[model samples]
Target: MSMGVGIGRREITGMVVGAVVLALLPMVVQDSYYRHLLIMVFIYGIVASSWDLSLGYAGIFNFGHMALFGIGLYTYGLATTLLGISPWIALLAGGVLAALAAALISLPILRLKGIYVVLVTFAFGQLVVQLIISQSDYTGGNQGLVRIPSFHIPGHNLMRDHKLGFYYIALILLCCSTVFLRLMVRSRLGLAIRALRDNEEYATSRGISISRQRLITMAGSAVFTGLAGAFYGAYFRNASTDVFGASLTTLLLSMVLLGGISTIYGSLLAALLLTIFSEMIAGLGAWRPIVIGVLIILVMLAYPGGLYGAIAAAARALRRLGRRQASP
Candidate 1:
């Protein structure tokens, strides 16, 4: 029940400081292009972090995670355009629908392990793509859905702000998702999943219900992922089958792995870093992907723990140096 697993004074302080800096970032960086990229970071941050809950913490090999996002995107698009619902409600509907899909998928994989889980999840993702395409009457198939409604403030214009409103909204979404994921990972639920991941037989021996925990893990991870997808649809005012493509799955998987596993903050950091870094190397043309791939391999080889591990290692070294200086 305790949701304060690894959080401490330093972590709390870091959260506060990081929030302040990001909140003030728009003022310092006035470029709309960069603002757009930051918004993407926020979106991917939510996604990669939520993924950490299942893939990293719970040890679930859910290759269909992006499907949840796609479901949200299409859900929001259809809800607003077809069902005549408010964009805001449709946004939440995306999450709910994706979570339901996750639960449904979990039922079959309850007893499966390893690559079997991966195969089922990956197939599920492809199945979703096929379904969307087959339902072209509503989904727009390969053409995608266009003219999706955007969010509205009471008296303000969201469109005229040069993406300022969207940026803040994305940031808020990332913040909420991070808080929710952190709480989930720090709660008893988190402990149970970690146990399951480490040793399923041992965990079940300890009276933990594998089916229940896995079910919750899958559903919990899908919530924010679907929300991000919904926001993606709303922000761009479009929904496409491309959302379920392998390219995006690879990108998000990179963020999760490069950020470090089992640490919620790691995925968020990786999302921020990778997005900015990819943009920075955009001028590399075809070499961009090659360069990025090489960089990921090198970093993983050097520090298997990823950026979080590197940061933690550096922090420990600095503390050791400080202690040495203070010692007689």
Candidate 2:
């Protein structure tokens, strides 16, 4: 009990320190280029972490997670640009639409298991991309939606020129997302989701509604991911077909895998590391993807449980070694 309490305290301390560092990051790093990279990190971090809620925790093979994100992106962009809605309201609308999309998709696909779920969800992602391309006029098709809009208040709308403002926004969003996910994973609902993941039949026998739990998890995950997507569109001032691309879905999956499945914060850490690594290799031209692919493969093979699991294992080994040395 004492050891468990100590571990809890350490975790809390680490989280507090991390929050402080992230909050002050913009103040210390004024470089626009690095700031932009960090923004991407936060955005992808949220998306990846939320994706884990369903994929890792609920055991839902949701390959179309990115599709919900893309839906949010397009919805927010269209609402703000076409209908001339406020940015704040548009952001909320994006989350709502994303949740709705998740619910709608979950209705049919939730019944599926194993590879069937994966295939249907994967197809859903592709379907979204093709639909956007087919409806060129509204979606901008292959050209994509350019000059959508940037985050702005009524009077102080300097986010276009100043990256600092956007950095803070991203930071706050990431923090909120982290807290929300953490709370969710600790809640009773989270337990039910995990139980379903570990033993679906057993969980169902215990009176847990698998469909209800999974649908709720899907909606929750989609909300955060959709918000990230909306932020991506607004910050970059564009909504491209690439937002719905499989490449992004692949990248997000790699982050979750490399970070450790069911480890929410691990996904965030992995997102930050991977995003920075990608930016560093951006000058590698065509060789970037090849290098990233190799790195991911190596990490997956070497650390089957991911970086987080690997680190934890190393720590435990060290402790055991210390205990042996201290023995009389």
Top TM-score model:
2
RMSD per model, one decimal: 2.6, 3.4
**Where does candidate 1 clash, by residue pair?**
none
* TM-score, model 1 to reference: 0.91
State the lDDT of candidate 1 residue by residue for 1-328, as single tens digits. Answer: 4554665678678888888899999999889898999999999999999999989999999999999999999999999999989999999999999999999999999989999999999999999999999999998989999999988889889988888999999988887888788878878899999999999889999999999999999999999999999999999999998878766687788899988899888898899889998889889887877887778778889989877788889999999999999996
Question: Mind giving the per-residue lDDT tens digits that candidate 2 earns over 1-328?
Answer: 0121122567678878998998888788888888899989999999999999989988899999999889889988888888989887888888899999898878887688899989988888888889989999888999988888766766665555458788888888888888788778777788888998998889999998988988899999999888888888888788988877645666888999888889898899899898998889889986877888788788888888888888999999999999999996
How far does residue 6 in candidate 1 sit from its true spot (Å)?
7.3
lDDT of 2 at 292: 83
TM-score of 2: 0.92
Model 2 root-mean-square deviation: 3.4
The superposed Cα distance between candidate 2 and the true structure at residue 299, in angstroms, equals: 1.6
Alpha-carbon local distance difference test for all models: 0.90, 0.85
